[model samples]
Target: MTIMPNNPPIFSTRKIDLFVPEREELASVLQNGLRYHFVEATVEWVDCPDLTQEPFNLATSGLCGDAVISEISGMSYLFPFMESEFQYSIKRIIKEIYNNFNNGLIIGASICLRLQQQYLVQLGELIMNASFSRITEDDIEIINKSHLAFLDETTGRCALESITNSDPHCYPHGNFFISEGKPGQVLKVRAKKRIGLQFLTALQYSLEKKYSSGIYPKLIGLGGTFVMKSGRARHHIMPYNWDNNLTNARSIHNWLHYCDLDAPLVAVGTLLSSNLVYKDACKFSDLEVCGLTETHFHTFSSNGAAGGHFYTDLESMDPVEYLGYFYPARIFNHVDPRPSCNELIDFTDVMRLATI
Candidate 1:
């Protein structure tokens, strides 16, 4: 593998005339004020830097329920595992992730199905009855009380068993899980209802208060994008709503960082979005980019799967020209249903062919 250079080119953008047809008013409002960049370069993975190294521990945090479902889908495609077998596999993966992270805390959040029916009442009940306190080995009663009925009996048992064996202290709020571990020093698993950064901030504050020390927590959002700005700014890029916010050089810097990782940990769902854009004249001069194709781009944009608007800021480094972005085609295992356009391929094949 060729080592990426320390200094890479900056990504640049240009104006494009693409807009969501249904939300034309909204798109017009966005297009009128913003300069859109139509990314023309093929996004390849070789040109980016590798971030899966020391001092940069990556962890996946998002909706565990969705994760569980995705796992089931993936497994079902590859193996002939029955319900019971699948449950066992799920438990094994959960345990494997917990152990892989060195017995660190794992946190998650979700709204209760029962509570969803009675929004006001449930909200009040949750506020009054919920306890956000840290759980320890002795806090069995509290853990059981706070547990929500989101998971099946088998899955819940598996998750609880994994936590109990690894960390001993845990707090389950609705669909969220917060296990006990050292602040920033140890690997931590955190999940919430789309407010992961906010939760992390709160957890940091709590840790500081409890331990009275500095903590540098390494976090990665699963099924989502976590971008670190040029300075100290941090933002979460969701799958939709790209045009709702202003994305400048700092934002692009963070996005490129995700693709630059050694393994390109950015989720496949995010890459499919139209929000990620570049200009026709922009040059990916420095970084090696990966993923997607002209056909995939057309499908994503025409099918309304992609949202958001892109704009150019001369002050920020142009990613296409400097850092470059990677948007590899989605990969599927042997069992995954093939896309009509044949866009999906195995990463191993990509690596072998691309010589990464």
Candidate 2:
């Protein structure tokens, strides 16, 4: 996936396991380049907004009454916020069985948008890997005031921070030690004798070896909770949010191209927030609070789509699932605006597939 201004690149990362498929589709889409207009012709997916917690009362629009289940991909779902208006016309329900290739894990899917035949295009590189959201006042404070600190890699303990006030405990970890850096005065992440000095050496060495040819210091953080902003005379922290740009729709889709989502692929086009964490398609515009503004936070809206390693791990025995993340998109690839009348396997009755 290619990254552009105002859009963050979403990437799924996994432990270095060469056995897994190599990451091929690294960069894909941009923000301004995106155009979305919902049409009933978009009848494929809609979690009818009729639930109690909903801010808008959509029931009056003749969209309420009766909770229903949508059976797809050999599974069932019921979003109370939704109603019977959009039921999958049970074309034909038959008893069918197959092997649980993913060991009961929820499978995820990569969305194929009908817009512009987008999936057919070539993958591009991300020009910038930083969040393009309007940097907030709070974000500036976190960057300028040294609110973030790195942990001791070994003990994993303030581990270290840029000396802000007259904290005699920690020495100034910078190049010029001036209030702000000059044009080319780049500040390096340094640890005091008391801090994780050993860790500092290892971290710098590791980053140098891994990233190779880069003179700039890296800003590291886990989600939106913690941040470590590297200071450079010419550098200023704009704004970065994990939910906003951790991964994009194409990153995970590209990565999952070869791998089988099986059951754990429960939400790819939430492709994911790890273990080759994929950010799913159509997830861009549907979040309540996307960690950028006060409205919503997260990439996939699936609890930020980073549900930890359990749902991401390939061999994870207990993979979890979360429905209702995608608004206009359905868990089932084909929504069949007209419920099926033909003979189809009944996903709800798992026992039917059982041995006699």
Candidate 3:
């Protein structure tokens, strides 16, 4: 509940050793650099002062279709943005990531899903605070086209440039990893491919009794993660953009201003840096901090920062039902016939269940 501050040495890293004995000589893979330090044992909520402040908004993009930025597996970038992107697509990314080692350098960073979902978080906040009634259908239409898909001509690099230009100090690119996680070093990232339509179920149910379909944004991704760098730190906090040259939201960029009463919706340097491992870490999830499962739960209770964020609100619903699907044990074992996040909640039933 307390406001966390931002300090120098912006992003930190952790020196970890991963031992996945899936193959004979491939027994060890190390250096998961990011390590997070939680304010409280139960990280119920979080705020990024540095990210929301001036010159720190550079990292608020998801790079929607660039799989090569960090040498991300084709599965990671493909499934999430492939229109009909699979939910557990990150698994494909991780599986390939396991083989990409050979004295190679992974410029790790977190890339959130496309832009439409970002708009949902923003619009959801507005409606969550009863601010939707103030906007007209035209505004709704504007938000609809914000997904920033990288079609033929649109360039994802432009978005990356915007972030790099904004955050010059302590940028986590160089291997000068930060040590412990705090507000800035810790971020919320989603592992599942998302359309973010389900979120509207709750938002509409909670309010919008008299609103129309205009309140709804086009379907897109909604997942993000929390990266804690030690060595594992800044790898996952890179600026992600759903925007490309043509689909740019230059007209309506979503900046996270600290002075605004609304929650911080974007970050760059302030995001927690994290890395993945083939050992004891939670398999396939982007938010894993330490490779040890015991410490992972001890650190992060959930992805994102606070209880008010869109993903947080979604996970908080029906704890028993939600947690049963999201717990660590099940996450590691993908062969258990588990489905993706899209199937978790029935959007229609949820919206229909909304009580005016």
lDDT on C-alpha atoms for all candidate structures: 0.19, 0.16, 0.18
Worst lDDT run of 10 residues, candidate 1, spans 293-302
Candidate 1 lDDT over 120-183, as tens digits, reads: 2110001001112223422222212122212122332101111112212211111112222222
lDDT of 3 by residue, 1-56 (tens): 01112121311122222111222111111001101111111111123333212322
Error of 1 at 126 (Å): 20
Superior candidate under lDDT, 1 versus 2? 1
| Total backbone collisions, model 2 | 40
Backbone Cα, N, C clashes tallied per candidate:
32, 40, 62
Q: What is the lDDT of residue 145 in candidate 2?
A: 19
TM-score of each: 0.19, 0.15, 0.19
Q: Between 2 and 3, whose TM-score is larger? A: 3
The TM-score obtained by model 3 is: 0.19
